[model samples]
Target: MSLINRLSTRSDDFLATLRKLLAFDASQDESIERTSADILKDIQARGDDALLEYTRRFDQVEAASVAALEIPRGEWLAALEALPGEQRQALDSAASRVRGYHERQRSETWTYTEADGTVLGQKISPLDRVGLYVPGGKAAYPSSVLMNAIPAKVAGVAEVIMVTPTPKGTRNPIVLAAAAIAGVDRVWTIGGAQAIGALAYGTASIAAVDKIVGPGNAYVAAAKRRVFGTVGIDMIAGPSEILVICDGSTPADWIAMDLFSQAEHDELAQAILLCPDAAYLDEVEAAIARLLPAMPRADIIRASLSRRGALILVRDLNEACAMANEIAPEHLEISTEDAGKWAEKIRHAGAIFMGRYSSEALGDYCAGPNHVLPTSRTARFSSPLGVYDFQKRSSLIQVSQAGAQTLGRIASTLAHGEGLQAHAASAQYRIKPD
Candidate 1:
């Protein structure tokens, strides 16, 4: 028998069982929250001294001053130059694609004049600076650098400062190389809540940023939560997720490996498959069992698959698409013939991988769209990070004399209805006495 759960739409309690299987507790740990609060307060009060102390205690990197932790531009360039030809080429290619994609998302200022000469428009401007937090040490992700920084640069942010924890003073060359390619203005050797604090609150060495983007551990998540009002944040993301809607036409081995891709992310990551064919589900189960022994992260995949993963048997592809919308998975793959025909039915998903060949892994790396997507059903309301996240829009209103006369009366009436005498009088003052 397969370790993963199996459910059928034919069962009376199928929806209930599916809900139970999909349930995930996203509550923040109290201990992590308290520790993060203390760290943020200390960093806010003591500035560079507190930052240095935390860096030593958490990352085991002893530095005399916070300035010493800042990686120089020359070093980032050198790391890029030192990379192997193939690696450098891949980085360059991915960066170019990402940059090109985001350039189209950039917003331009626009205005229109009315007949009465009332000019109304919107002014779009980029944030002055942004902070990107990259995971370092063994959990290095160069792709994250491109995903977060390039969009901010495309939006015309003046500076992009990056923070990555260099555990035991060990830095990943690929991360530094990505920083160079992504056009990060500054790189700081820091991590944890303290890094978020330094970026949000600013230290003697590091300037405060308008926003902070990227991912980290529990403590970092807590820090971002606490400092949200002080600085803008991308989103409080949950675990990685992938929900595949297959029609039993795709190869069982291909489907099994697709499930394994997300399962290998961590023990909590979710990977589910929905299909109408019972026999094909059995084939996938066999494929999973056969392929399990060879996987490098087999233990993690097994735990994830056994815990949150499921092989859900739907009635048809239409039903599968409905369930996908209800799930609002971070990644949705439609692995069937004429995938586009089924995709029209999907209303919510962070990213959709159409066709059997478009793997979620490709979207994670070089696919032009952003990899930092909404998770845990947030695709229902939230969106993928892009150039728009780094830009702000201000409404412009220039009322002509004749236009104010007409607008003032409408405003005064509404103000009076709302029982705001001062507002009514303010609008009345704008109206020319006739």
Candidate 2:
């Protein structure tokens, strides 16, 4: 069997074929959603009691009180200090870069005075508290910790609460270390839908957060979906995706490994390559076959490549750019001499990795951009998570008495034309008698 799918833009039914390849069923499992709903309701009604019970049942960890599960500030600091010199340096550098990048994203209050003495502006304010959910049970993603929490801290969030499940009462030190470096204010060893419930509804031990951000299993996602009205959520991510547009100048092995970078994320993750030269496509395919055997996650990479990965032969660079805009992938890599020139043509993508050396993997770590990006073509309408996600803008407006006379008269006219007596009367009251 072929290692990956091959397609050509010249095919008569290429669009239909491409649509079929990109098809993904994002529907949540009914059973998981139902279970999550029950968990949420129980936690809301029972508060701390239900939270502890669910944590014990799901994580297999017993705790006398919710406070017992809370990781103290000393533990977070100790975790950071205990790391090996090299490991600690890398963590510190990554956190520093993430913080620096998000600092520029912070929105500031601004106002402009009109000629009529009316002030119009926007006031930006950070959330009071935010919750971050990190997946646990053998999976350690310090990158996730840095990506989510650093932005909140940079946005000036007063408190950041983190929850991670500790299966069998084991905690991953690197995750804790990252929490310290990212300025996470508090953490608890609780996860799944119950943790989400505790954050959204507020248990006796934990206060409700203004927003929740992070990735988790289906149960956590379902809980977030249910509690969206009560609190804000980042997004319901689809899958990891990387679309590489090559000009046939980059090394085939480099392109192949780039595909594997995202393919290794999961079976649903997609990695596609677009190049004008058919020969380069052959070379990348050959490289994929040659390199697949040695990868540590060979099975996962193979599954992802075989299912959603593709090597497409486009008519030219322009056609590749067109296809990329259609896909609106989570990550876009322009591997060419004039990568910057081509990037200008791109209308949609969560992040653009330009030039032959700018691999998507770098952006995932310390490249100074938030790795929490839009997926499943949502890049067309959405954006990467950053300080903006943790801050809200309030419209600011002030009118002088003289300005109010004119504005109120206009409002009264519009309100009367719209046939609202109360609105018209309210606006007329502000107008000066002639």
Candidate 3:
């Protein structure tokens, strides 16, 4: 698990390596698209039969009917109560923190009036219902439940529906507790693309949702992309990524461990260190070697690092910032003196941690900001999931005759410039002559 760098024949060789590491082009083949399309079409046309077949094929769950897929409300509460008091309390506390943080993000309809009799404003309204996809594989992630559902709850979404894959009769008690804490209206023991399909196109038991949000495997991501137009999706998330720009302030072990935190996500996950000082880079490499063996997921981390990770030898902090922006990593940690000052140059990161003390893990769970963020350089144009994801904004416009006349003529002239006669006439209807 040492830092291995392939010889770069040219100055931009790193870019090609990065593209492979990020797996940016892995899904370019239309197989997933074609397959997902077929599955979606089947579910769309055949309805329950397609859903049941896919559920059995993918999830290996033998559900005779849609009613069997639905997780009973009593079972959910019983599972939560089944957890010992402290674990339940922890889930409650995490949910409370998440709810309180997102409550501040709550928006209200607002309007503004001008002396010229023009009214312009926006109406903020929560979605009627939203479906959250919680992954059931690996270990239980109660934090994810809090992260995904609490914001929708804070945004005042009427019904927050959760769907998680529970094979046969294995339900995660902590996950249920977290869902209960986050005010989920319903829970379904279904997962994978089938669950997404059910939410996108309402089944006999599961209702259609206005928005679907959560993290999942490749199939889940592809399904989200397929169902995007049917309902809103948070973002087409990619593999996890982290970029650390250090100025020899933080410990090598601390830096190494932080990099591994994201690397263990998958082989495609990335952890890059952009530092000007070569000495610090060497120390960090040693630290990575020393720490990698101790990690439980060392094999995964090793594959991730060998494939995607890098210790870039930038010329200066500016160069580091340039590389960081080019990558637009999901998590950017500035571990230099006056980290905030260095962070000002960062314009394209999902989230910025502006000090040595702030690790990426804090942002993953307890941090108020969403851990669900854009990845694979999408941060250049995207943002983290938030109240904004669950809420919609409708622009409000009002104009009196005089106000209309003042603006209408200008709009008409512009529309005419574009050879849009109908648009010009629509605006011309309100224009007045002196």
Candidate RMSDs in Å, in order, are 1.0, 0.8, 2.8
lDDT of 2 by residue, 238-357 (tens): 889999999998999999999999999899999999999999999999999999999999999999999999999999999999999999999999999888999999999999999999
Candidate 3 lDDT, 132-204, residue by residue in tens: 9998844588888889999998898999999998765577888888888788999888787778888999876
Off by over 4 Å in 1: none
Query: TM-score of every model?
Result: 0.98, 0.99, 0.91
Task: Give the lDDT ranking, best first.
Answer: 2, 1, 3
The CA lDDT of each predicted structure is 0.94, 0.95, 0.84
lDDT of model 1, residue 159: 99
lDDT of 2 at 320: 97
> What stretches of model 2 exceed 4 Å from their correct place?
none
Better of 1 and 3 by lDDT: 1
Clash pairs detected, candidate 1? none
lDDT of 3 at 427: 89
Best first by TM-score, ranked: 2, 1, 3
